[model samples]
Target: MAGGGGGGRSLEETPTWAVAVVCFVLVAISIVIEHIIHLIGKWLKSKNKSALYESLEKIKAELMLLGFISLLLTVGQSPISNICVSEKIGNSWHPCSKQKEEDAIKGEEIPDDSSEQHRRRLLMEAAGGSVRRMLAAGGEDKCAAKGKVPFVSADGIHQLHIFIFVLAVFHVLYCISTLALGRAKMRSWKSWENETKTAEYQFAHDPERFRFTRETSFGRRHLSFWTKNPVLLWIVCFFRQFVRSVPKVDYLTLRHGFIAAHLAPQSHQKFDFRNYIKRSLEEDFKVVVGISPPIWFLAVLFLLFNTHGWYSYLWLPFIPLIVILLVGTKLQVIITKMGLRISERGEVVKGVPVVQLGDHLFWFNRPRLILFLINFVLFQNAFQLAFFAWTWYEFGLKSCYHDHTEDIVIRITMGVLIQILCSYVTLPLYALVTQVIN
Candidate 1:
């Protein structure tokens, strides 16, 4: 895409091989890296101390969710590409207005020498109908060249190179540095054991720490409908088995104590970060971070290679972003409702269990910290939704983008709602569906 080949072609016109290959390669790389991580973990298990592995594992799940989001953005958005031609992967991604504005300034073919024309363009964009009116204005003006497509600097070679080089450097350095810590005497398994014991002792003395257990699931009211669907539970139970096959890859930050309490075996649950992070090296807690870089690399390749078929699914990567948003929002719901469930007897509460909680599933059991995370995820979700909504209004509905399907605001809105519903309600909805089928 960088040189002369893909410069003028639309996304639909491009071949799928480039993007598909990129995706494949990145995924392969991720698999390889994870294998290396596993080997390191295995080696640590032999070493008996594994202090370095413990440290890396502690940061793994945090890296997973955060890195996954970053990977999504990295691959889906042509961070390196100008806005006009930035489309790459993912289902829910959309070009931000700021990026588009920059692209317009850099890629604009029409001479903007006239002050009058520039002023008029600014006003139209601010008023929210920039495209249609601008096209109309371009029609009346001699310089507009009505039928000619606007020029764009579609070459993203520099952007891709810089991003890849910098990320690779950081990635290499970070990996090496963490591995180097393994050589030191401090981070060994013994050190981790001591830290875990200390943390456990502190948590036991703190009466407020009980909230970080499994009781923070969705309330009975939100899940009232799923109680009747036994078959749906069966399906989820079966699905869990398949997922558990690769449990090591499933670890992620979303499993704060609340999520963990519901996802792991209730009998042996622990709510300490210190314990869980080390356990993550041995289990499913590090999946997200392990896979993020490879996915991101593939996304970058999608852009750098100038892959075709970006518009094929109206941005498939965007869907995952929203799903991630839904999961985070659902957690906020749990935290908000968690307060109402506490009683005179203590942290006993009722809710739907998504999965069994892991020992040390939470980052920490401190009430203040938990409260802060809840607030943080809430504000973050709100900002993302706002941005998505704005982009939908500004660009999605506008006629300028390729294809009528993507341009249909009504359909896009409904699709988004449906996606959100599927994210949070799929298991229960499956149960409801199975009841009817049975």
Candidate 2:
């Protein structure tokens, strides 16, 4: 009945091209934010000059990106207002769009002899078509009520936007605080490294001070001996686990043991720690880039569906979250496989073989399992895209006056639910299929 709520501007007054422009601007802003965070990380690495600092920078950047994405998905769209008609029948309120479709199904028809009635019917039909077009284009719609029913309100939508904005702001601040603490920890680690080197030198040059004598009393041998040599005391305090595992405690044994425990791979060696850290950061960045498109598509679809008044499918908003989980799981499997390959090549970290950790069932120890997960991820992505297209075609293009809409929605929802359930039950399903093939 009334116009849309942005400064009394009607939905029809907003050009469809403006929606495309807004989407473009939002995407540009997201890219700029990501680049700025990356530059900040580079600058922090230059200033701190520590691998730990670089790691912290990656974490801060990821946290900020996640917060920004959450805000964009939740509150980036135009506020909802006066977009649809809602009728209050008794105490329950429902969209008049549904009511109109129900009346049409009951064989309501315009009188052919009444010119005024025919004109009004034509106007209503045109208005309905325009509303559908706007929704399909990812824009809002406004409908003129034929009855005394009011336009749908926007107060709740505004409240939700404000709440999500506040949470996003808090998330950003939390990430900043964590970076500050991480910087402090980095400084402490640097000091500890220096002290460890100095202690090792002292222990090497003055081994007699750390050794025990045959005539020494028990109290002096245990307490006074280590207390007198602060280097030994510090080494014991820091490398207590290594000390416990050592078979014998002597100058050469303790010196070699400490060296083996503390020293990382040499920079010139094949598996450089710094390069490994950089590669890990790069892999994380690649994952973020890979996942952004699907999330953006899902957000646009959500806006379109919300404008079309598809409240029965509220679970649509969570699809992006599920997609993210699946992507992460697939990445984990990939990383584990890579780690296994490196381990097979005899790569070592800190004198111990590198081994990736994962659940035995899901870990890809064989080529067949790797291929299965790869195909599974591709199939899931294709299925989701197909499902979205089908829903959009059936509900957006075709009018909802037919009874088939309910049946279609139900069938599609069930299929999606089953597919998601199978994704989680992947290990069991894969084992079952393998046994059948055998």
Candidate 3:
């Protein structure tokens, strides 16, 4: 089969080995960067800068993953573009034609009447019979006659790869440096837990320290003014409260709470932190094992539907997955609420320690759950791309002769834009809803 047309330009092929080598190099560099960040964290710890160290670690973890994702997007573009513009004809695959004129110029042998009719029948079936009307519409087919490919050319793709690579590198460096500089300037802003007094008390005792004045740095003068202004201060307070109203599950906070509850049983008993942590981890591992089967089953089911030309019915598989996540979230919330109640009463519930019960909750299995969520997101993205490619091949390519290239391009563009919007906007909104529900 032939590839999409740009003066007979074939699909830009990337060697499998080259892609593998690039991925390996990216992983190696990420590992090195992480090690450097770890060393900086240790130095911060020695300087008693616990807040800054934790922030650094968090930044490192997030930026490293984002950098890897950016690199993967750059490296995978060519291969994904090739898949988008190619079609399978019978047992063989060929590049799609950009224009009907190119098909005539290629001087391909004409099939017998019956064979030609069969091919037309196949094309019509593939296109769900939409091609006939598209062909009959003369002036409306001008956009299709242009035969523009769905995405950019090879050179443009290469330039995009370079741009993404540079942007990823710059983003990582800029964020890390900004965090370090900001933390350095706020050296006295220790973690709340480490302070001997409350934030309000500290502010009341030394208002000058917290106040913004003419001597304040240029970057912070506006922030100082906002704090000094009555209206702006109310707005800031409202915004802060609004942000705090959002539910957030912090793993470290949960773990520390569990540990404190467990150790509260004996005031004089020597607490073995390492042993307790090890036991908690073992229990959490068992919970993860117990939950793995259903998650894996749903994933496999989705994969089957996705690969078997059941694109239209793909949403069916996600139903069970969503149900599982919701049920798990509810169970987690119930367990946490119960634990908090027991802690507040200072009594054991049914002789089960809060720590032991917490270990079995979804909160402890968060890392595994996050991993699964990432996999699900990747699968969703793959499904979106596959569905788009299938539609382009079946609908767009079949109607190519009708000069419907503009329609094809528009459909492809819309599909891509929707995929991005769903990934970033829709998915996050869904997650927020789930969080709110929990």
Best by TM-score: 3
What does candidate 1's lDDT look like per residue over 1-438, in tens digits?
222213345658868997689889999998998898788778877877555566457555544654665565455443332233212221123222433444444434224574544433332322211232233212331112342212221122323333433444333343343223322311332443343346563454243433422333333322333323655433333344223211211121122333334445331234443344334322321221133444545444433322223452354434444543333333333322332333222434323222222213223533223223322322222222333344343333441232355435433563444333322223122211112112
TM-score for each of the candidates: 0.26, 0.28, 0.30
lDDT agreement with native, every candidate: 0.35, 0.37, 0.37
The TM-score ranking, best first, is 3, 2, 1
Candidate 2 local lDDT, 73-176, one digit each (tens): 34533433443454343113222264554443333543457454343332232332222223222344443244322232332233334434443443344334
Off-target runs (Cα >4 Å) in candidate 3 are 1-314, 320-358, 362-374, 377-438
TM-score result, candidate 3: 0.30
User: Model 3, residue 403: displacement in angstroms?
Assistant: 20
lDDT of 3 at 298: 58
Per-residue lDDT value at 94 in model 1: 26
